[model samples]
Target chain A: MNEVKKLPLQEAANCLTPALRLAVDRLPEQTARAAEELRLRVGQPPALSYGGQETALQTAAVTAADLREIVARAARDSVHSYADSLRQGFLTLSGGHRIGICGTAKVENGNFEGVRQFGALNIRIAKPVFGCARGVYEQCCRGEPSSLVVLSPPGRGKTTLLRDLIRCAAASGARVGVADERGELAALRDGAPQFDLGGPADVLELCGKQDAVMHLIKTMSPRIVALDEITSAKDAAAVGYAANCGVEIFATAHALGLEDFRRRTVYRPLLSIFQYAVEIALEEGERICRVHPLKEGAPC
Target chain B: MLKLLGAILIIGASGALGLSARQGLRMRIAAIDSFLKALSRIESEITYRLTPCDELIALLAGENDPYAAPVFQDMAERLTHNDGLSLSYKWSRALREAGPACGLREEELGILCDAGSFLGRYDSEQQRHSLRLTAARLSAVRDEAAEDLKTKGGLYRACGLTLGILAVIVLL
Candidate 1:
């Protein structure tokens, strides 16, 4: 069983500028481990976000140079090497932490060239909570493989639950293929997964979700395919196609609850394909996941 | 017999001095040429491979050029034991500490040091443009050094021998 490790908040702080890093390091260990994101903006004191609440640190205000240095360090002093991610306004660090960028876009011919003059950054720390999905696994994935959708509003541990669920399914002697588009799930380094996915898991890193799904189905012939952030029509279509082919699908999406998920037209096609929708939410300062069955006439 | 031996000794010492001066010029030219080649390779690496600055510096260090290699080697070492400093700072410091011994002129050292400021700080196109500009400047300096070697190289040797003969005649 994969045990939950302390969140790598100090590791994330090391990616910041030296002064800012010092300030963050001074935070209490409990606070550091509980932090969800590190927020930095020009002319504002650095802040840490905990479960959607932002707490300002007692450090000096951030500067433009500080922001530039953070980006440079994250890219290993080679900004051009991360041009694609910079254009997409986020950089996934080696430890699966994501640094979201807010900057002036240097667009050419209406195409986004890249970001320049960074104004702010949101460093979302990746906290992999192991065994968080045991309840869902026992309820939905005990016997036969099932297609399921993990749903929640943004920042509600949807991805975390989905990751643990993938590990559980893979441990049950099923071949699991992960389309890690943003590298947040597997965080493969030097062709080896940084996260302990499972013995039977194979990850295609940094590939588009739709293409990765089809490729995984055709080549790997996975019994279950897992992907993060199903946002587009293409992703839904790929999931539907994989379902039709009898390959179990595991995916996550952004919605408040099942009702909100069903109302979104982009997710309607996915509803029929997924037999269960795992809703992850925060209740009384603790995470609560409720699994809802969506077999046409299933109860709310 | 003693007078003749003294003249011979004088001429030999002066000739060696002239040759040493000429060798210095040649060394400078060779250093600049080596740097130019390294810059060209850096441009291609940045444009095509998107190689990081540290890896590129390490690659240059492995080239084994006596003049340019030590500077890159020093940089690679500094990057390996990085102390949270920027690449530009480490690069400029490496050149200041290791550049003069590479037989480059003060102006050439300044040009090379300036090139560090823009490296790994921008997109590929911008980086390529900066590297190309630095290369062109270094190439111009190399051409001037080559011209000096072609025109003044022989002059130093001839002057050394003539001065030796003049000193011999005056002493006799």
Candidate 2:
């Protein structure tokens, strides 16, 4: 039985050993002797394997039902029916626990979803990755209501930074409202956030960022309205609305450099509101070096 | 003498079979993980890449536009065929319905659908060939693993049966 009392996402992720045998040892089994459980264990794996052989098992975890749960929760602003939603394959849980799923993708009546069948599951454990936002905290929150945007090359740690910011902001009493559209920010399962997202002044887990920003501005009255990735013109416009409403906005995106940021016509309007930006370049050395100020272009 | 030789062979085969099953499961899982990672990279790229594509498309569609609509044409013209995700049409179809944020159009999905039909035939054919090759390798490995498992269990049962026969022989 799990510790139903406190759903510790970090702790659960920590227990994921290198292979099957190690994982079972971590489990609290009702056996007379714990070591005896290992030898007698017939079908279980030897260790929690991460690389090579274990990769196949990892992929097996991403089922469509798991996708439905993650996606449904992210769209929490409404009542999602599994009937129409395309629950991809799997969603990685906090600390590397994988959830699998299956379902037909709900698309327009005539249109087909690229994501079909969705009948496998692998909830890769997503550990609460720390030490990511060390440099950006002070620069992001200038004395006045400030807006800072983080740019990454993808797979670099944009969400990791956002998660840390949530923790940092909540600790600082900023009344932050996070609009996690992808259920990645505050991974809450079984009615509680598994990741340490601080105490939420307010959190709209699965709500669209643009819609949530408007709703939070009108109702929640948060000091800062945060979001994950700004993908479209509507989303960029919403950031402007948040700024106009005097609510600071914090978010992440993928881009090469300042030129790439400006070239984006749909997201261009957002540059005016975004005063500061930190670029996350995914290299071994100089991974995160320079901070770019939109007020001052490239040469900085 | 024959029974003893069979028992030795059984134990040896059992260990090898167990190892092989573990390896096969691992290989398939790795492929899936890599496939997903590839998909994510593509998604992130497509989202950002669409802005420029949309601009180029808009300009081309507009008679009084500059910078050439070749960019838009390029998107539709590109030839693709990958076992996991080579079809641009599959991606295009999803984007059309993914709301304004994802840049998918429900009306234009048919264009992608047609492209998918053509592209998918080749893709499926290639995948079938690849799977056949992989399946052959996997089958051999599976056989070895099964043989090993059978031996372990068989040894225990055979041990009991042989002992019972020996007792009967002595009693007679």
How many angstroms is residue A67 displaced in model 1 relative to the true structure, after the best TM-score fit? 2.3
lDDT of candidate 1 over B9-52, digit per residue (tens): 88888888888788888999998988898899889999999998
Per-model TM-score of chain A alone? 0.91, 0.67
Model 1 TM-score is 0.91
- In order, the interface RMSDs are 1.0, 17.0
- Model 1: pairs clashing at backbone N, Cα or C within 3 Å: none
lDDT of 2 by residue, B13-86 (tens): 65555555444444333333332232233233333342222232333334331211222234333322222222
Top model number, lDDT? 1
Highest-scoring model, DockQ: 1
Those runs of model 1 whose alpha carbons end farther than 4 Å from true positions after fitting are: A1-7, A296-300, B150-152, B162-172
TM-score for all predictions? 0.91, 0.46
Native-referenced Cα lDDT, model 1? 0.86
Query: Residue by residue across A148-191, what tens digits does model 2's lDDT show?
Result: 78887765667778888767777777888877666667755534
Best TM-score among the predictions, by candidate number: 1
